[model samples]
Target: MKPYNFRRNPKPLTPNDIENGKNFNEVLKAAGKPPLITPSALKWMGIGLSSLAVLLGLYFGLSNNTEPETSFVQPLGPVPFTSALINPEKDTLLHLSTGSTIFIPAFSVVNKDGTPSKGPVEIKYREFRNVGDILLAGIPMTFDSNEARYHFESSGMFELLAFSGDNPLMVAPGKNITVRMASLNSKDSYNQYYLDTIAKNWVPLGKDNKLFYTGDSVEVGNLKGQNLSKENWEPIKPVVLNPKAQQFRIEVDPKEFPEIAVFGETIFEVVPSEIAYDPATAELPWSDVSIERTAEKDYFLISFSGNGQTLKILARPVVSKSNYVKEMARYEELYKNYLRLEKLQAQSGPTAILEKELSRYKALENQRVADMERAAFVEGRNNTNKSVVYSVFSVQQFGIFNSDYPLKLPNARILQPVFAFENGKQIPATQYFLAEMGRNNLYTFKGGDKIQFDSEVSNLLVVLLNDGSVGLFPASEFGKIPSHAREYKFVLEKVETSELSSKKILSMFNI
Candidate 1:
């Protein structure tokens, strides 16, 4: 069988052609030699033609196998062109008072074909915390040829979500920008970093502020003193996450420990850890200490010299070192002043003026002692302890001093009633306000106040009152009040910290 060939003569063989071939063969015979179309020659031609056909088919098949075949790839879906995108290069932790802005580089939404994807880009933001993540409004970013921008007004971790219409295109890791107190100078400031078990990384918080971490532990100390860089951080203690509870309110029932009765009309308040009191004035008359925990383990019964009054305090489980630091400074200053006054009194003895001045100095001297006791009580946080708690004794009675009173009861109020504004209304004592706390300024509008400002232009104000109350309010500027606001419009509601003496006694003894 001859191999099929397309490129050949168009005309088919005819009988005249065969006859011409036979005449040519006869001429070749007249010259000499055998006939041209012999049986052996025909047989050899058939075998040779068959072998050629097999070789041609094998050559084409092997050539196809040597090189890869080209085909179109069906895209899984529209892909975000992350290759050209860049995240924020600035440090996530910010100490800006007016807040900060971050720029997200322009990135294209491309399809499998490497062409720009069809649809509008939407950017969403939210406040990130260890316990709860707050979701904010999603706005369509003003794309300047694919780039977008964002700003933060408060301190916290913020996350970004970018989408091409309904489909999620990309998500940016949390970008943290913290706003600090405007009055505070950052030259001497430092941050306390914690181990974020959720993220498996170390996170930073302002050293002066109290925070609730959901992680197993957090490392806290002066970054410089500890020689801790971001990579070398470690946890100071394990953090027990209280998901359902955010704060604890401190309440005192003096009847349980009536031994504290000598201090009549005594108002109790929880002091911050920062205060240092005079030691001589802080001596306790009673002498047994018994600390117990409730069944739910939410509250602790801290009895000082069990013989004294037992105060029931509800407080979150977290300690703040800033309080202790501040109190120590006050303690040292007052002690030095008291020593100088004593020397002056000795030099100018027997005079009425010197005596009166000495008496006043003595009162201040007693208060400093109380401060030291309170500071010591709150600053003792073991690895398993929760938050810091203390009591300040303010005397309402001015008569002769009672010998039974717990040595020298401090004249200062540690825990003041904190107020908050929720849903455009004033709410009382919602958050346990820490005394001597500082932050960026904020404002709060009480009922009946017609003050109005462009909410868009207004910022939060950190209001620190003389009574040691700190709160956030909506305002226009840091120090000034909002415009169109009356001077007396802002009502500072009195924080009711404790129950009446009679009522507390009755409840304690079940009268």
Candidate 2:
């Protein structure tokens, strides 16, 4: 090789050398076009995709946010009945104080009977002194199908003789005890009105009077069950007689008197204040507080500042008697209108009576609730208690329906289960299951045929077969029934499980 000129002479180039030094513009001219994308172009595309991702995230992230409503309702303190509002704190307070009763305050007092329950219906705390209204006697009792209530009505006379009810005061026409004197006072707690009496110088004629009134008084709860007997009325102190007492209340502990229970010992206080209640409905759906029956009366003796306490007196049915007088009073007032309207839109006397009883304060337009109840009560009093009970049942069902679904049991572990037919297997022979079956078409079982359900069998229950009926007898009482049907079909109509009644099952059907 010749001696190279260091600065001027380039090296004799290889093919790689020529390609490396070549201008990009010249190369593009040689090739048809440049490569598809430059580095800058790729960078821009990635940036664009990143921006799109960012936008999507923002949209989804904000989607959960909501605009609140402009306004909301504020509770105006306690509602009409002061007793109804209960501070949840009362529960805690009850546990803290054992000497004083943990008052339930006011709850939904569902009426037990339809005929306006009459007073003088007694819940006997003892032989001599009557406590409260157990089952008011003559109060024209009936169910208002429309209102769904057990209505106590008046039968012209206030005492049991005319149309009596269970007397709250056990005193009667000519008994050992005599009411020497009586006084009455009318006062009300809300828009609701009330009346009560005060007795003085009452005497018992029998020799046992001393023992009946005196002696060691039974403890609060025990006094109810003919628990004690005493003599010497002067020294003994009775709850009703002590006028200037603190609370004017009856304090009883449930632990002692277990016999009188509500809802089968689970609960007992079944006082129905508004309209109607079921012996079946022992416990409230919303409340789990256990209640017990005290003297079978529906009234509550709520003690306050002194012995003069609030008496939540039971409403008696004066409907039948009152309705007659009501009509007679307003006969001429609406008769001409009835004549003009052909009685198609006549004003019956019950309208006024209803207005007086339920919708006294609320305007007629807004008093549809009270008005409807009155009309229904009047209509049903003449019929059966079934109609009245059905209405109350409907309301209870409605309450249950509107409430949170799938009611849970008192013990959270076990759910409140409704019995339903699972397998095609049979059930315990009971009256309701086949109440309305026709008398003509039914099977009668012989002694050997009794199907006993035991642990061994696990599934079968003994059934009693009878004319036009089928009964599900509990396996425990096997085969002793001479002639029985687990179910029934009565004379007036066909019976079905849906039509069974407790009274009928025990009384009419001989279940």
Candidate 3:
């Protein structure tokens, strides 16, 4: 076989090899070697490719994650709770610093098993009076009625709870506690509502009766007291003839000196003992004399002035001896009546106060008895008076109660907001709040939600940013937004959560 060459004829260079521009030497070297990739090398190559695929997958997965990092429904700080201890065996009246009052009837609280609870049950109460308080408390102010959602324009809102030795107590059946909640808003349009925690909704009770007094009524009561004080009159002193003292008679003007107007034909007697009076001043030939009332009752500052010089003397009004005798006789009878009236008032003042307090409890007791007889869950009475405005409600359960009017969101303008920092850095917000300047309603919304508000009304927007900072769109900017604009871009001012306070937040909203 012609000394057969051990090297098999190298495969003929294919068209692909020529097109690939492979040199003849490289092709020959490739043919002479065993297959460059062995099983072991292939295994290693497979492992390397798998590792690269996993790293790429992880990179894309994290980049696409869109979940919120943190959600904050409440304010940064804790909401404080006020507590008071009360004996369940007796009716207790609790007063709060906010001027709210709670009247708990005897045996109103019961054990979980429905038996009456004993000992001093601690009553815990708190109030949310402003936008900041409500937001910090995370209390929902929205009301859903008849498939329509509304916001609560609150007059006042409060929460109440009772406990005994760390055990929660329930309100006794057929019994209710009365709450006289002081309200800043004196409007009569609000209705009472109790928050149903289990259902997470507000249950409308009825119209809230507002008790308030007019300024005219208060003035009438004050006038009656003034009239009584005027009825108890005293006699004036008679003018005594003194050879050394100078005295003069003057026709007193009723309008100018109304204090001594009742005494007819009065004479001005100089009081030498007064420190402000100078006896030498009486000798001046005064061109004009003017009388000015002094701090002392029935006394006057008699001034004589002429040629740019003024002389003032202390003087008092006095009646003649005969007039004094006639006035004194009438005064004696009036004084006797005044003494009798004073004695009666002294004896009755404390008794009247005690009776007034007792009457309140008695009235409450009567109402409680009547409610029990009818087996009613709640009972309310309208105790209107000329005093403070009180929004009263009776609760058969321990929970949050509110006096509010449900208001629909303003539909004059609707917007889809895109929140960004003043520096144009976009922030993701999970929730936001809208507060109108004059209205006590707080409208809240979720992310990707449409915000509807009246453009004419001053409004404030607050958003809890994803980076754990507060973003505020102030009220001043509300007027700058075009009414017809649908998509609004809000340039927010970033505020550190630590620097925020209830007063500061309220001031920002102009509450």
Q: Which numbered prediction scores highest in lDDT against the true structure?
A: 3
Count of steric clashes across candidates, in order:
27, 79, 0
Two-way lDDT contest, 1 vs 2, winner: 1
**What's the C-alpha lDDT at position 363 in model 1?**
55
Query: Against the true structure, candidate 1 has what lDDT?
Result: 0.27
Query: Sort by lDDT, best first: what order?
Result: 3, 1, 2
Candidate 2: worst 10 consecutive residues by lDDT?
Answer: 391-400
What is the overall TM-score of model 2 with all chains considered together?
0.16
TM-score of each: 0.18, 0.16, 0.52
Tens-digit lDDT string for candidate 2 (1-511): 8778567776788999988997988878855442334322222111122232342333233222231321111110111100122221111111101111122212211123423223322111100000001011101122223333221111111111111232111222221111110001001100100111111111111111000100111111111122221110111111121122112113334333322111111111222332233332322232222222212122222211223322121211111232344434444444444355434324443344434533432332233334334654566432322221100001110000000011111111111111113243333222121111111011112222222222222111212222322333332332343333443211122234234333223232222
For residue 108, model 3's alpha carbon misses the true position, in angstroms, by 0.8
Q: Give candidates' CA RMSD values in order.
A: 39.2, 36.5, 34.2
lDDT per residue (tens digit) for residues 1-511 in model 1: 7778686677888999887777776677764532433322222111122232342333322322312221111111111111112222211221121222222322333333444434544433322211011111111111111232111112223333344544434322222222212211111232323322222222333342211111121121122222121221111121232333233222334343222222222222221210221222224553543433221122223334334453323122232343435444544555565467657656875467545644664454445445433543465412112222111111111110000101111223111223343334444321121111122111222222233223233233222232323333423222354433343223333322121122221122111
Q: Model 3, 1-511: lDDT tens per residue?
A: 6867687888998999888895799888875553434322222111122232442333333322343531223444334568888889865667677767677766899989999998789887878777777765556788888899778788778888788876768999988787767755555568889876545578998887543322111111111111212323333334443445556776767654444555667677775433445655665677877775422344555777788876656677666666876655554655566578667767766455546645564454444334332432222112211224567667798878898889887888898999999889888877788988767788878767788888778898888776667888888888888877889899998877656666766777552
Q: Residue 22 in candidate 3 has what lDDT?
A: 53
**lDDT at 246, model 3:** 56
- The best candidate in terms of TM-score: 3
